[model samples]
Target: MLALLRPALWLGSCLRGYHMHAASTQQRGDTSLVLVDEARRFIQDCLLRVGVSPSKVRCISEFLVVADYRGNYGSGLNRLDYYLSDLQSGHAKVGAEPSIISETVSTAHVNGNSALGVFVGNFCMDLAVKKAEDSGIGFVVAQQSHDIGMASWFTFRAAGKGLAGIVMSNSAPTMMGPNSKSASIGSNCFAFCVKGEEYHFVLDMATSVKDIGAVEWAWANDEYIPHGWAANEGGLSTCFPSLALRTPLLFPAGGHKGYCLSAVIDILCGVLSGAQYATHITMDQNQPSNLGQVFIALDPEFFLPNFMERFDDFCGRIQNSQPADDSEPIRLPGELERMHMNYVEDLRAFAYPNSLLTKYKEVAERLCVKPIELAFDRCQSRKSF
Candidate 1:
């Protein structure tokens, strides 16, 4: 398994690098590091006040914290506002759990009832793992859920159980097909995990040339996007952040190749699940996204002998291979995330933007909870507070 973690470079463009700063507090300068435990408590407190069930809040908070720990900050606390908006707008219901609309020995179809997507994802993946444990494989599809933060997390869960896992989701239409200017399909994402004795391979990514969230982050941070990632209304590629956000016509990862893959994922996640598909799923408040997701788990013991041993051996060979660039070493797909977790553990605190921290304070005030105290530099003012 010469697992090519393949640096986020697709189609000879560094669109993925644009999000390397996902964990950055700002474009430049000193940043504040919020204590992780404090942040978690604050999030839980706020969500509970906003009508989220205790179990649901725990799951949601842990999910977001893990994302930040793994350096996937774009999907971490950065998405808090979006989640809050959905809950406040009556788009998501508290204490909603996925119900099995249909099920078999090795397959299940669930309806999330417009609840938080993390709950749906956890339920479907857990179901898959249970079925796989008993029947060698488990396949689950869920509809009517909100956004499932990162597709990789569910697969990683299965990997922890020594099973192969594949997960995918169809999102609201915020992406375009190859050579088209208008948004049509989603940045539809897929993730896979292969278990090994001591390590595992986890690959999660959007089929688009760049993640749409990258553009959203740029828009929020008042930054510019790189060329070739997005296009203007005229179908011409542009680098201006404002134009990209307004139009947001994303390019396919490898041109037509990515477009085809995106389409297939939508078929698996949206069309197959009988949920909203293509442009039918939109960001309009009046329209329900009815997002769909699929999770599959496979037990290696059912088919292969000495699977873990062989898998580990192959991974070792790839890791020991010489790199063309001496400065950079070859890494498996999940290696960087594991490394980031280790770094985060040592820090004990998570760094975020001052503006975002202030927003959290506002949310806390609105929820009538004690705000988390933030440490800031002298250049900032009391008037800002």
Candidate 2:
């Protein structure tokens, strides 16, 4: 009888090990794709099937995947679930077309109608670039848009069109008062793109010490957030009474300077647009309310002749500036992202956590898409970093 039980126990352990192996392989599947065009096509088809228009779907898929290809998973493919949730909850209307709500000789306001931000943002930026080309300058404001991917993408669009672009957005309240006990502000972000001589310069940053997504990711991974990294007991401000609180206010990057810019962005993106501000608005995420965004573009010709040439010269000087450390060279804002993109091209896929892999499988199942397979051959080669 004991021998019989031993065999059964051994079988059970082997089954558990098999499951673990499958989970591990699924998570570690390579993200670098030798066949990137095929992957893009696959993603586009998937998005279209879910009700996004073909053109819009193409742009959205590219925007999301660019982040993945750059190793910014927090803002990359990992965010698809959030978009799906918004679609299912009626917070985002798939296939909704945006319209110009107001306009001036040099300015326009757009109503996104709860459309995906990627499409709406691209549309607005394109309009801005066209206007700038004709009028020497253009300004655009959009409301009722859902979370747009990286602001740099929009700025780059403007740069490609020979215009300087500035983008801003107000996110759900995630910060607390400085030295206080209450939440008082939003996680605001700002970005800029300017056509340089050799390469365009792009700068993008969140006002918070780190993005809210970073904090959320930490929580998901069962990691403890550092003090001054989250809100305190009441979530009213950026202060904490003790270190044991589950959440604490996130400090602003660059201290008061970032805090000030955050306030400015909230005013422009939220107040000027007549949208909810700071803690008053709701996020697309199922969590408590808080969200907003803003974008602005400028034509360099408005200020100077041979603007692109001058800009390039300025960037060249900055690039050649002495490095603070000899081991690391100075780098422009978008240089890291560019390097990451190149790295992914050589290595086929990204390495994700086992838990994230499981979640991806679950999401795929819910959408009726084929589950991602668990095998090394299905993985992409890694680029030599």
TM-score per candidate: 0.88, 0.80
**Model 1, range 1-385, lDDT digits (tens) per residue?**
0011111111001322553333342233323556677778888888888888887889899988888777677788878777887887767767677899999999999998887888889899999999999999999999997899877889878988989999999987767776577889888989999977676788888888777777765555445677878888787888776787676688888888988998999998899998898888868654444898999999998998798898889989999899999988898887777766665565555656556677778888888998876533321432322
The reply for model 1, stretches above 4 Å from the true place, is: 1-16, 19-27, 220-222, 375-385
After superposition, candidate 2 runs with Cα above 4 Å error: 1-49, 217-228, 231-248, 284-292, 379-385
Give residue 213's error in model 1 in angstroms.
Answer: 2.2
Clashing pairs in 1: none
253 in model 2: Cα distance from truth in Å?
Answer: 1.1
How many residue pairs collide in each prediction?
Answer: 0, 31
Candidate with top lDDT is 1
